[model samples]
Target: MTPNPTNAPARLGVQLQPQHANYTQIRDAVLRMEDLGVDVVFNWDHFFPLSGDREGLHFEAWTMLGAWAEQTERVEFGTLVNCNSYRNADLQADMARTLDHISAKGGDTGRFIFGTGSGWFERDYDEYGYEFGTVGSRLDDLAEALPRVKARWAKLNPAPTRGIPIMIGGKGEQKTLRLVAEHADIWHSFVAPGDLQHKLDVLARWGEKVGRDVSGITISNELSRGSLDDGHADALYAAGVRLFTLGLSGPHYDDTPVRHWLAWRDRKNREAGVGAAA
Candidate 1:
């Protein structure tokens, strides 16, 4: 289910890409991010390194998410965007349900948000022995898979405490945006500020045509130093975006950008007269 936007003021999240960092460092960074008031944390699903040294130590995403579920107390967690091609729909649903149970630990279970995308990284497909079909075919697979995922979630023995939120990430207008309108609780994209507004306009149009209210769907965009400073966040926020994610890469896991964004997030919430839930 889509979360109530009015419940929290806008929230800030960080993605700790597990490409270069060791398990200890990655775990420690998540702890620190939670302490520093990040509302959500995530890691990408990939077996090999995405940057820096190609052969750098890397970890599987869902396994790391299980570890994270046990480690953090206040922060919500999930894959920044799990590739749909990597796992079967039922398996992904089961994994998400298990993570939800692990994170909730006898409490409320709305903590896990399953952020996924139609796979794009070709190298992952080649290395993992999955068929790397055309983009259209992959999107078709994703379209078919989403319903099966939802069905499996319902059929699981211990159902998700609360329906786990489904976040669909991509900017493809025809297929991706249509799927977002039909199935996503959250929609993530990386378009520029100007283009974001236009794309969102299109998304809303699609939602209206499908009789869905796009207003309930959270929109997320990646945060970087220059991009955030270029009025991208402000523009997107004005365009109905609420959840903002900053990607942190490497062995260092520099906190400077994260700190700056947190400050910015707080200020924005204050200016808007809303207290964000931690």
Candidate 2:
């Protein structure tokens, strides 16, 4: 397995779930999160609320992303994991490239991150008229689609301002890890601290099979389910997670939990001899 870089500073992220709130509230939350000094901001790709009211106020991911590209001055942004089944691969690439250009302030490269998955939400598929195929079939489709997305990026007119970072979210060892080895710049997973090392071991074998060194791929973990008091954050960091993300629901978009994680991140970075923003 690729060793966790002991010197690397931990980065904080938050997924502003686009449910249970209005557009203005979500917009305000975005601004607040960036102000709170997060390294990245994310949103989920679902048509309905995963919690609370089944028909709560919700917004689409890509369109809001266009707004986010133009709204935030800093902090990378993307979906926590876009459902690959929602759109055509080439169109997705073009949309990502467009956002990349839109996010490019001054002359810097775009900060858009293309975080995607094979999709599993049955309601989304059923309601939206997409095929909720078998998990293996969906994974197979994603494996095919990702390459097309990359190839399209290469052929786009102006091209992306930067090589848009590809973040694949899943813990499936065989197919998902292989795809991560083949394409991902970041791998987002929910593997528990105790299981992290084993997952990393599986990832490494996939990397070897693909003939790609996976050491450069950033390890991302979800911290939304638990508090930092449990020491899970520290354990994930110790294992290899450099990007720690939490999910914030709407209405008020509370920053209390965010501040706690931010403080933890600052402390961790300082201990590593890095600046808070680093």
Candidate 3:
């Protein structure tokens, strides 16, 4: 019999955009998501909303994470991509370790994925008093921060329940992919079906340059609007993406589309017949 690939099944994640809603609403939404059998739940790291109103109600990422760490019983969760510019690397590492422990309730690899990226939103930087550095500078900062993050994890009082998986989100081939090859356990992007192979090729080259086997790194693709077309998912699946994320806004995130995505996840898992590690 053929061995089932370790990453055979595709998984679904919900990006609970923490905007335009109260904490209770967000909390209830997460419970509802868990009931739907979503594999993961995510919230972005930003001080303000990325869409709709600029002054919409939004909660902080890491703080809310602590609550999820305690509240969630089954679903894995984390920042869709935490802004590396906002916090110290060591502190970030410590916080992740603590959350990892909190999430380890009966006994499981603590369901916390540390998804992060270089800061991009100008408003988050400006209003939050963080420096709005150039793109190059931010990427450089992330490259430097990752090592410190790992180092801190090593020296923590109580280590993480399991080595928290580090996921880096971005598509820049030069610095970003190189960093992914060096440090990330997963690489996230919005590459279309047509461009997916090329990006994977670039990532493979980066792995060779860094002397790391990146075939193990998970590929996370966005649930884009245009990607909603028929056969769109098939093309992406054929391209080797296994972790899909759906972005939803608060005040009232539409649940109809979410149900569709969850059903797709179930069908994909049933067909694959193995847990999708990616």
Candidate 4:
């Protein structure tokens, strides 16, 4: 884990929920987001939409990531949180490496973030022929898979275009935090600002036990799902969050919400004396 100090530069990420929109609409949205200067763009790893119609129009995550690699120029793109249950760890490593190369503008410098999590949505498993294990077992699987992922990256032919940042999402104090302390370059969680301090405290303990300085791990928080304005981003920053993400659902993905968050992000970045483009 790359232990970044608590004062890491503020950044913004946008998650493009792959549901209800056709490929053209999704593609256009992604391009528009890049133009708006989000530091990262993401899509989730799931076979179906998480809300509003379980059987809604949805696209696979990694394949679309591959598309994002070809589509955008500057913004880093990735899975908001890939479920590790679907494929072998080594294969994922190879895919990440490939995407890294594809996103690289100058020969080999990819902008791919490997954000992943243990499988949670059970329907993705039942329908896809994966063994739907209990939560603990799934976490165990994630813990086991990540090292293999790194190892595979090391052994890949051309290697990744650059060091891929591993962003692990979850707030499980016992296993997830420990994994973040051990493996994550970015720690993503849904904990609101009021609850963030305690999670950070736990993460620090995990860091101490793991003998890793998690201060370098970039903190990521999600924007409130229902609102358009900034809710706790500033508070989260005060509590050490540097990456604020907002996810948009589709069919008709209004750019209004994203633009609002972008405005908030710009203000925060200006205050921090950092360019929002990075």
RMSD of each: 2.4, 1.2, 2.9, 1.8
Candidate 4 pairs with clashing backbones: 3-216, 4-215, 4-216, 4-217
Predicted candidate 1 versus true structure: per-residue lDDT over 1-278, tens digit per residue = 22225434678889998978788899899999999999899899888888889899888899989989988887999998999998999999999998998899656565788999888888899988999999999999999999999999889998888879889999998999988988898888887667776787788888888788767888787775434472767776766667888888868788888888888888888888887646
Better of 1 and 4 by lDDT: 4
Error of 3 at 251 (Å): 1.0
Which runs in model 2 stand beyond 4 Å of their true positions?
1-4, 224-226
lDDT of 4 at 11: 78
Off by over 4 Å in 1: 1-8, 225-230
lDDT (tens digit, per residue) of candidate 2 on 220-240: 998847465638888888888
Give the TM-score comparing model 3 with the true structure, all chains together: 0.94
**TM-score winner between candidates 1 and 4:** 4
TM-score of 2: 0.97
* CA-lDDT, candidates in order: 0.84, 0.91, 0.86, 0.87
lDDT of 4 at 163: 78
Q: Name the better of 1 and 2 by lDDT.
A: 2
Worst 10 residues of 4 by lDDT: 1-10
Candidate 3 whole-model C-alpha lDDT, 0 to 1: 0.86
TM-score result, candidate 1: 0.94
Stretches of candidate 3 exceeding 4 Å from the true structure: 1-7, 226-230, 275-278
- Leading candidate by TM-score: 2
